[model samples]
Target: MYKLGFIGMGNMASAIQEGFINSGYIKADEICGFDLSEIATEKAKARGVTPLSDGHEVIRNAEIIFMAVKPQVVEKVVAPLKEDLKGKALVSMVLGYDFAKYETMLDPSTRHLTFMPNTPIAVGEGMILLEDQQTLTDDEYDFIKKAFESAGSVEVLPSHLMGVGGALSGCAPAYIYMVIEALADGAVAQGLPRASAYKLASQTVLGSGKMQLASGLHPGILKDNVTSPAGSTIKGVKALEDGGLRAAFINAIEKSMGK
Candidate 1:
């Protein structure tokens, strides 16, 4: 079995691990995590992973070490594991920190991959972004792709674009949720029961998205088809436009990027 070592047993790590197992790419026993917290270690153990006392042991043992800890702890955790990082693969799930920042703490021989995975991979429908420093051959790239294929729709994004593009897909699920909630709120305001409002809003959103994808038409054109001159939709759409809904989303993204 190909072994993967995770240094942190947080939500993102657990999600990816579960994704791998459920997709049959990797077995649970083939993965391991080293955590100082007893709770974390126990959680990983319950998930069928080998538990270790410290991150160093994971570095020494695992062929592929995932630095899945929080961003602030990454530098500290990686420093101790640097000596053992040689010849092994290191994949990082820590956001904001780049390859150069990590290289300062890793052995030069380590093959490092920066993988940006969102929380949605827990359900197996995630958008994952991979950016790497080392030049990989087509076969090497495909091999890496296979691992992520089990988690989500993986893409090779240019390093420069990662910052801007990540703001969209990385935070898409949350954005979508807020929209769904707002839609439900509108329905509930009109006297629909909360459960019924949610049902209607969720299905409409899902169905509309599927329609756009299946029809392969521009969204504006598709929307135009829905809003006849005398239709109720145009008035509702007018209220949305007047409320600056589009501008609100734009500002939300910009605010997220600032953080």
Candidate 2:
């Protein structure tokens, strides 16, 4: 079995671990992790991960190491462990950090990859964006891709596109949650029970998303199908348009990317 090590035991790492174990793609015994917070390590241990003494211990024990630390502290955390990371495949989840920075900090020969995965990975329905620095062999790349496939759908894209893709899929989940909440609020305003409103709104969004994917049709066409010339749906859509819903979403993405 391939050994997996996580250098941080935060939410994202925990989610990935859960997805791997739940999908039967990786065994608990094959994983090790480390975190500065005792509570974080304890939580990881509760999930059957072996909690290590430090990041170096994790790097030493596992062939594939996940760098799940924050972007701000990544350099501080990884700089000291440069020697230990040699010959290992480093999978980084730090946002806005690139492979070039990793190569500059650590051994250039170190196989490195950067990926963006949303919170949905906890339920095995995530959208993951991947970019590599041409350092991994075919087998190594395939292994990493297959490992992440257990969590959700994976898309490999150019390094330059990671930022745009991350904004679209990575940050869009929060936007979607907001949309669901607003829709539910509208239902509640109409005198529906709060719980039923949330369920109805959430299921509607889920089914609509699935239909768009399965049908392979333009979303505008799909919207037209649901909208009649003189109907409630059209009226609702017009209200949304009047409220600048489209521009709000587009601005949200742009703002998320620091534009």
Candidate 3:
């Protein structure tokens, strides 16, 4: 059997496959998947993923199955194959679906793992939020954890916190990208070249994130370190604070979590 099987070989699945191969955790030939889109199949093939005839063929031939289908079509896709999934380990990347819901959809003996991975997974810097599920064996959990850690950071949270954690890590990337763009726009307005501005803004954000992670310091402390008394940085900080940046982020997360 193949090591990993993907039901939907879209961008996310392609990223996962790339991560597995890049990390040397799983070989390309050992992975197989199916996608209705010819373009998706071609992309997967470029990454050395073996294209399967159908989702059932993927599941029947692989040890662990990853279901990356859209949330709206999850039921439609799985209903026909629900019986075939018995006792199988399913790693689901579908949004808005939780472990409790899976328990009702899948067989009692089937093991399920729900994870939220952002678009950054394509670059090996993704933050993955995995729900803590006891249904999986120790070895199974270890394999899944190591697989993702090989690509990026992995956080194991209880099901209750998955939504908020996903919002912070999964959904926040877009916000960061927007911030980077805005910073670049501000620099351009101040007469900096567009390319240089984007590079500077992007790299600054990247470096700040690395520093925060490496130093294990609070972001507020890091901010304070940069904002000196009556300095330019402090002025910018005041502008952001005055603009309600912090509150905007808080409200965004609340809205994403349906609060």
Candidate 4:
């Protein structure tokens, strides 16, 4: 049997497979999955993932199954697999779901938990948000955690915080991508070449994030360090403040969580 299986082979699913395989946590041949799209199935095959005939086949051939289907269609996709999933560990990437919701969906004997991953997971620097699992044994949970940690940082949070955690980490990448684009545009406005501007902007953001994580310093303190007295950095910071950048991001998160 394959070690891991995916029910959906869309962008997120493909990215997760790439992450796991590249990290050497699991071999490509050890993974199996099924997607309704022929193109997705072909892509999986190209990645050395065993593409099964259907979700039921995936369940039968894999030990751990990742459900990355859309939230709206999750019930439709999983409803028929109740018996097949009896002893399996199912990690769900579908949003707007919690343990309580799953209690009504899967077999009681099936071990499952919510898993929130972002696009950056395709690389080895993503954030993985997992909800504490009540049904899974300690060994089972730790193995899952370690497997994912090989790809990115893993945080197991209480179910209550899963939504916001997902928003902060999962949704923030798009925001950062937008910030990178805007920074590049600003540089281009200052006569820099677009390609060079984008490269610089992207690296700056990456370095800044690494600095904060490595130094364990407050972001405000880091900003202060960069913004010397009457300096250009301070001027740029003032412009961002004037443009309500902070409020915009805060409101964006709130809107994302449907608050």
**Winner by lDDT:** 4
Candidate 3 residue pairs that clash: none
TM-score of 3: 0.96
How do the residues 1-46 of candidate 1 rate in per-residue lDDT, one tens digit apiece?
Answer: 3378898988788888888878788889888888777877787888
Q: How much is 50 displaced in model 2, in angstroms?
A: 1.6
Each candidate: RMSD to true structure?
2.5, 1.4, 1.3, 1.0
lDDT of each: 0.79, 0.88, 0.90, 0.91
Clashes of each: 0, 0, 0, 0
* Candidate 2 local distance difference test against the native: 0.88
* Per-residue alpha-carbon lDDT of candidate 2 for residues 55-77, written as tens digits (9 for 90 to 100): 88888889888999998899999
- Candidate 4 lDDT tens digits, 1-259: 8888899999999989999889998899999998989999999999999998999999999888889899999999999999999988988989987888998998889998888988888888889998885577677788788888989889889999999999999889999999999999999999999999999999999999999999999999999998999999999999999999999999999998999
| Model 4 per-residue lDDT at 245 | 100
TM-score to native of every candidate shown:
0.87, 0.95, 0.96, 0.97
